[model samples]
Target chain A: MGEFRMPSLGADMAAGTLVAWRKQPGDVVHRGDIIAEVETDKGVIEVEVFDEGVVETLLVAVNAKVPVGTPLASIASAGSIAAVPSAPSPVQAPPPAAARVHATPLARTVAKALGVDVTKVHGTGDGGVIVRADVDRAAAEVTSTPRPDRMRQAIAAAMTRSKREIPHFYLAHTVDLGPALTWLSARNEARSVTDRVLPGALFVRAVARAARAVPELNAHWTGESAPPLPYVHVGVAVALRGGGLVAPAIHDTDTLDVDGVMRAMADLVDRARGLKLTATEMGEATITVTSLGDRGVEVNVPVIVPPQVAIVGFGKVVDRPWVVAGVVVPRPVVTISLAADHRVTDGHRAGRFLASVVAFLEDPEKP
Target chain B: MKREDIEAVVIQKLAKAAPGTDPGSLDRDEAYRDALDLDSMDFLRFVDALHEALGVDVPEAHYPKILTIRACTAYLEAVLAKR
Candidate 1:
């Protein structure tokens, strides 16, 4: 018998949601066959089986959130759980009459530590046996302490690693927006109140264009100093309820149309504010931009997301004075600050990126 | 295509599609935002126009290439040339 456990994709991931099962029990599985879809912060990824085996028992159900090293299923040629290393998670323990209820190697170790009757705790693990969590939970209940859930631990590790390792360089530029404000006011007046164009939508478009102009800023930076990616997968930061943060990438904002971008932004914002994002959507961000303009943070130096080379911070749009062809004029200007990875991009490139972003914002209609 | 010609075409198209942008006197190869005021909305509009003008789809896989006016123009040109 062999144990099929969930492998940890990264240091940040503790548990993964089994989105779907590609393979079923009793069907023979070969190595490299896509067995399941696991949701991690990076998005939905196909999980492949490593060894060829006969599926003996299905240990976990689809859509279940199972921890790393958990036995997703078990494979065997005959009635045996003794051959596998261990089974480490709970499942719907099978009928007792079908198989011998023996504790797995790890389960026996955990059972010895907990002193719980492994047979009595109910072997929900593969082949009707106790696993690590059953023993730990049984032990915890008696001890009166619950472990921190998998989500919390994963989030902590990702954020901590991002903060410590990435060296960030900050660049800020104030947009001169006399013409842009003029254009916006006229455009709003021309359209019905119900159909007025979105300034927020316009800003998103601007960032997309700016990144395109300074293409180098669009990719994620490898911490070990590898070259950045050529394409830009833009991440939009949205504040969730209860005051936490999650930045979900819009896939390719640089390539989407205004309407498409508007819809995507709205959908992602709604999800980031709620619970709609899959682990895959949350995980793979090439670059991210934040909008705290609603919250009134004028200038923010956000930390560079690991693997991502830069993050743009958007702040409040307020009226300010500016020069137009040597004439002083008033305008509704906003501050755009870019936090870039110093290791991959220089100040010259960063400045150009910010400048391009400012230009895009000032005239989003420009093709 | 010469860099200048590509930049001019980008400026002309952007002005027609979204207006109120100044395609400054900087070198044509200068980045779009550095030489002109075409924010994200303008950028999106530009992409839409590029698709319409080039008769080429900016499929999900090709989106990352729409970075600069020259780059965008070159992509459009390549897609059109291939067609």
Candidate 2:
């Protein structure tokens, strides 16, 4: 029998509340099937099972807060039910006072606004008190409005840890995107509105390809050593509507074509805003790319997300005067900035990585 | 399509693009992107939804013409009338 534990969705995630179980006892399960919904600081993540088997028992009750690595379920290997022992007792008891309506003032107000019953909502806050986010989750079953207060706290924790632990160095390079925009427009003209690619996808693809060329930037810094990651799962930072943001990964970004990157990016943004991201997408980024698209910011010096040694930032694409063949001309340009862990790589290597990105963006069709 | 019908489609798509935003609260003449705090991707999805709903092809060059509900209705009505 194999035990399925509560996954650590990110370095900032310490515990998650079990929102619901998708699998039941005696159900046949396969690897990669979503088994549960876990509520974390990021939002409710669809947790997937890695072991293929028959679910023997659910060891955690819904609404119970489970720490990372705590077993939440048991799965028996296929056709080995007779050899396996009986289901183990639940790892945690459900929170007390299921009938009692204990909620924060903000939660009560939100519940009233959203037309959700305070008593019916599960409280995941301290001492099993319902919070505003809990009421939002109860109202919208599949998606919830992330409580700005909680999200801000989460961001504060992660960013503070990053600033404290990671010695960061910043680099900036300006790339002319005139050729890329011209090419993209021509390519998009032939496709349907839904199928058309965006310059954002080109940026992500360029960053992924650049990471492949500079493997040192695509790595996790684990204290004594920073080993390069084999795959490039580029996290795209998406700003949420209400407040806060999430950077979910597009797995194997380096291998995907521009079209694939666009599709993946669109889907990730949709899900990230909807609060329906999966655990792998939440946790498996080897590097991150943040863009302040059309926000009119010329440049941003980003902070590194912990463990990941590097982050690439893109500012608004704007028309600027450029000298070409000794002549000044208007061209669309964007500033690409890199924030990397100084301990892992120096400015020389980071400059080369930024150059590779510029080259890819300048000649997108070739990459 | 009638202007009301087109307006409904825009509102429906806008709701999907930015969930939790109340359609009833939207100012018809205000730029929806600013009103809804939608990013470029969300706006693109809104356009994609408009295409799927109305069979209208909104070129990238014409994005500014549909920035608000009032503007989108006018644009769609013109496109649909031509069709």
Candidate 3:
């Protein structure tokens, strides 16, 4: 039997509340299937199972808050001996509701005061016991709790840690988008609205391709000497309609074309705004791209989200005078900026990655 | 379609793409990104909605020309006239 522990969605996430479970005991589970929905600092994330097996038992009850590495469930892997006999079917009458409801003394009092059924509320206390906070939360459900406030606090904590530990180096390159714009126009002219590609998507693809090309910049600086990730999953930073922002990965972005990236980006942004991001999407980013240019800023210096060595940012694409082969001319230009961890890689390697992105954007047909 | 009709369609589409945008208060001649706080993805979705509504293909080259509410309606009118 293998224990499925609560996964750390990022370096900042310490604990998560088990909101719901998709699979129950005796249910067959695949490696990538979402077995539970976990409410973390980021948001409520669809927690995926990394083990393929039959779920033996769900250890943690719904709404239980557990720290990272707490075993959420146990899976009986295929080919393992089913040696242990199942417990004898309960022959006696079910226990009384008060006897069955394992709750703390404070929780019992709070539940009584609020006229709440303690048995109905899932407990986060020791050995699946109800707590006072759980009772308070159950009582507050009628009043409606705001979601983003907690998420904002979580982001603040994570970004704070990122700035504290990661010694970051910043680099900016102004890429002329004249050729890219011309190429994109020709490509988009023939495509339908659904099939048309956006420049943002193109940039994501370029960044992914560039990360693949420059392997040094595509890694996590965990202080431990770990090997680089085998593939690039570029996280696109999306601002939520409510308040906070989330940067979720479009998995294996290097393999996707601009059209594919565009669709993925649109879907991600929509889901992110809708507050439905999965844990795997939140955890799988090898790098992040934030295009603040949509608000018309020319450039932005970004903070590196910890562990991930680099972040790519883009400012607004605007008409500007540029030098092409020693001649000044008007062209659509975007400032591409990179914030990389100096501990993982130097400015030279980051520059190369940025150059690759610029080159790819300039000749997107070849990217 | 009349310019008003086109503008109405554009505004409806914009409102749909961005849930909280108030089309009534928007400046007709100001850039939609500035006026509506629309990102590229939001703008693209708005364009997609327009294409679905009008069945007119707004090419990438015309994005800048039709960035404002007034310009988008005028551009759509010209496209409809040509068609």
The model with the greatest TM-score is 2
Which pairs of residues collide in candidate 2?
none
- Model 3 agreement with the true structure over A260-282: per-residue lDDT tens digits: 99889989988776556788889
Lowest-scoring 10 consecutive residues by lDDT in candidate 2 chain A?
A: A142-151
Error of 2 at A342 (Å): 0.4
List, residue by residue over B1-83, the lDDT tens digit for candidate 3. 78899999988998887775787568898777766767778888888899899998787778888888898899999999997
Q: What is the C-alpha lDDT of each candidate?
A: 0.64, 0.86, 0.81
Error of 1 at A4 (Å): 13
TM-score for all models, in order of appearance: 0.54, 0.88, 0.81
Task: State residue A129's C-alpha deviation in candidate 3, in Å.
Answer: 22
Worst 10 residues of 3 chain B by lDDT: B16-25
Off by over 4 Å in 1: A1-11, A17-156, A181-197, B1-83
Summarize candidate 1's per-residue lDDT along A67-90 as a digit string, tens digits. Answer: 998998777644432353333434
First chain TM-score, candidate 3: 0.82
A1-367: candidate 2 lDDT, tens digit per residue: 8999999888788999777788887778899999988878777788899998888888888777879999999899877866655555454566675326677655654554454767778899999999988988888783554433666688889899999999999999998899999999999888889899989999999999999999999998888989999999999999876678889999999999999999999999877866788998999899999998667788978989888999999999988999999999999999999999989999999999999999999999894
List iRMS for all predictions: 11.8, 0.9, 1.3
Q: Lowest-scoring 10 consecutive residues by lDDT in candidate 3 chain A?
A: A84-93
DockQ ranking of the models: 2, 3, 1
Expressed between 0 and 1, the share of native interface contacts present in candidate 2 is 0.58
